[model samples]
Target: MDSIDEVLGELPLPPYVTAEDVGFAVKALAVHAAEQWPDGPRCRNDRAPHPCRLHRWGQRVLDQRGLTDRQVQVLIAEQQAPQR
Candidate 1:
């Protein structure tokens, strides 16, 4: 099976990264977050290996935004956290 990253590589980039692109990136991250598996926290969104396309895309966008790993983690946490 091809990894999501591989598929992502095949994807063509849009003319430019816009706000809509950011939204898609966020969705990708949330959808492709790791899941707790019997073996380990594998990618739940896609069965095609860990760090799926969406996940990678999200991380890339976050990176472009100048976020560190810790910062991305916090952002993701906030997204998943309960909205009060």
Candidate 2:
């Protein structure tokens, strides 16, 4: 699948992203992160070609939130880290 919502149709973005949206966006980033594949990389969660829809959505959200590359890396690492 390309995204969890694949064929479900796109949802509209909020006029402005709220804290709740950020939380969801972060989760999407974590869950939909890219993965390596024999046929080339794909989304770990969605199994779409790497950097799939949700991934792009997450990136766009992070960018809109003014996160830098380094900050984004930190965010991704934090998301991937095992919980205590």
Candidate 3:
């Protein structure tokens, strides 16, 4: 873990995972997707370590909602698609 991560700590999770929460989670995961860096992979959004706080929170929410890895990928892809 990075020094900043240690200082900032992990983001809190929602008490109840709802459909809206799932949507937000999907968005979070997609927006916070990892980026390659000279040091290593980091968060594209916040530029924190890979699987940043928001990213981990999103994955946790989706896991709580019973979404599999494949399902999560699909959700991310759908979000990435251009709106017609």
Candidate 4:
């Protein structure tokens, strides 16, 4: 973990996961997708380590909501789709 991560700790989960929270989680996962770097993978959005705080938080939220991996993939794909 990076210094900032160590200092700040993980993002907190909501007391209750809701559809709106799922939407935000999907957006976070999509936007924070990994990027290949010379050193290694990093967060595409924040340039932090792969699976940065927000990404991990989003995943946890999805998992808590009982979403399967395939479902998460579909959500991410839909989030990434271009608007008409």
Candidate 5:
């Protein structure tokens, strides 16, 4: 079956990665986290295949920012932490 991206196309990335873009990216990854199904992994939020479009877009944004895996983890952790 054609993936959502194949039908609707990918969401556009910002021309320039900014702080706000990074924040949004972090949220996207957090919200679009994967879940296991009998067949395979899928997006927790949308039930689409794992690594859904928004998840990929967020990864690309982080890649464009040259963030290390550790940094990305920290960002995700911080994103999930309770706010004061």
Candidate 6:
């Protein structure tokens, strides 16, 4: 069985990385985070494989923006925090 990613292919990156794109990417990473399953890790949001299309796309966006792993983590943390 082909994975959803294989069927749909990768999501396209932005033509130019912008602050808004970075914010969307951060949200994607947070929402598409992995969860442990009896079979294996899978996407928490879609039940697809872990590192699903959106997750990979988010990583690519952040990479294009030259964000470090630490910086990405911080952004994700902020994204998950409660909004005032």
Task: Supply every candidate's count of residue pairs whose N, Cα or C atoms clash at under 3 angstroms.
Answer: 0, 0, 0, 0, 0, 0
Kindly list the per-residue Cα lDDT of model 6 for residues 1-84, writing each as its tens digit.
Answer: 126567788899989999999999999999999999998888899888788888899999999999999999999998788999
Candidate 5 local lDDT, residue 69: 82
How would you encode candidate 4's per-residue C-alpha lDDT over 19-62 as one tens digit per residue? 99999999999999999999899999999989899999999999
The lDDT of model 4 is 0.94
lDDT leader: 4
Worst 10 residues of 5 by lDDT: 1-10
- What lDDT does the true structure give each of the candidates? 0.67, 0.75, 0.91, 0.94, 0.91, 0.91
Q: Give candidate 3's total backbone clashes.
A: 0
Candidate 6 residue pairs in backbone clash: none
Where does model 6 exceed 4 Å of error?
none
Error of 2 at 61 (Å): 1.0
Candidate 3, residues 1-84, lDDT tens digits: the string is: 668778988878788899999999999999999999999999999888898888998999999999999999999999999999
Q: For model 4, name the residue pairs that clash.
A: none
Tens-digit lDDT track of model 2 for 1-84: 444557764545667877777777788878877788889888888688877777777778777877787887786688778999
TM-score of predicted structure 4: 0.96
Candidate 2's C-alpha runs over 4 A off are 1-11
What are the models' TM-scores? 0.65, 0.72, 0.90, 0.96, 0.92, 0.92
Strongest candidate by TM-score:
4
At residue 71, what lDDT does model 2 achieve?
82
lDDT of 6: 0.91
CA shift of 57, model 4, Å:
0.6
Deviation from native of the Cα of residue 14 in model 1, angstroms: 6.1
Q: Which consecutive 10 residues in model 4 have the weakest lDDT in total?
A: 75-84
